[model samples]
Target: MNLIFIDSIWFTFMLLPFLIFIARIADVTLDTLRIVFITKGNKIIAPILGFFQILIWLVAITRIMKDLDNITYYLAYAGGFATGNYIGLILEEKFALGIQMIRIVTQKDASSLISNLYEKGLHSTSVEAKSNQGKVHVIYLIVQRKMIQNIISLTNQYNPNAFYSIEDIRSVDVQSERINTKQKKYRHVGSEK
Candidate 1:
């Protein structure tokens, strides 16, 4: 304590950079998730994640500023940021936490697909729209994010050559509140008869 200064050569060159690297990784991962939560309209969790993210960020930046001449710190910070983004995306995909809408545009009939969806307790609506090619059935449905693969499989089974797009459902009304709770007991389980 009396002889060696707190910013010793070993600490500045080795330990400090390592600590900064780890801190940056944690901060950026939390930041990525925080942004996702915000986009998903999660009011409570985003701020909590933001709080921890910034706290770790401040600690890391303070270290970076103290050793501005060191290039190792910069490389570590950048590498950590990139790695954190990759990990965060993987985690987000694994979580799959939201509702989505799948729209299938097919020139063929959608009755079979609709029936299959109904059997699976999923609701679907079909509209006969005139496309440039011919009449198309624009079949659409609200689906939980986890069931997206199943929906794609069913569409492939029913409409072999169908064009489909999936979109995030940002909000739902009181009528369809079941998307957020009690998915199994959703009162309106099937589309219009």
Candidate 2:
């Protein structure tokens, strides 16, 4: 009886870490998918993913409770968790689910390029600043990820030597409702000009 109890106890302890590790990994992976889905404008899929993620985590935890002495299991569990998080983030990035802000730093005058972008139905802001190499005109635009190629083409045309940067913009809210109308008119007027 003593040996049986000892064995059971040892088993439970050893496996606890592994169980927790696996459960966390599953949970985080699901969260990563959920965020991606939300960003992609898919309202239905994210919740479904959350449901399965929680269910898997519950099962994993229950198994860990039954065996506590499995040290190797515990270590493996933790390792699996770290690996899962990395995998989840990579998978999410591969999906690329949202709008991005593109910033262009040009070594020369880029007002014409900015004017062209606005003419093409994109909103842009341009400012003149001094850099290490001297004065530069920086242009900022917030565009959908798919529009980046077009923007890049414009940048190459206007400022081949211009430096540029792009970053993901998770959410946006335009405070001025009139801005859209103004942008549309700006495009139409530029075309006619």
The prediction achieving the highest TM-score against the true structure is 1
Q: Poorest 10 consecutive residues of model 2 by lDDT?
A: 178-187
Clashes of 1: 0
Worst 10 residues of 1 by lDDT: 180-189
**What clash pairs does model 1 have?**
none
Residue range 1-193, candidate 1, lDDT tens digits: 6347556888777877888888888988899999989998999999999999999999988889886999989988998888889888888888887788889999998888777777767767789999999999998887667778767877887877999999998776637732432255332323333
TM-score of 1: 0.84
Model 2 ranges with Cα > 4 A deviation: 1-26, 35-47, 111-123, 127-134, 146-167, 172-193
What is the lDDT for 7 in model 2? 62
lDDT of 2 by residue, 1-193 (tens): 4667646755456545555676778777887788777766777998899888879777766765565765665676667677778989987766555677889999878878877886777777789999888999888887666567767877888888878899877666666432222223333322453
Q: What is the Cα-based lDDT of residue 83 in candidate 1?
A: 85
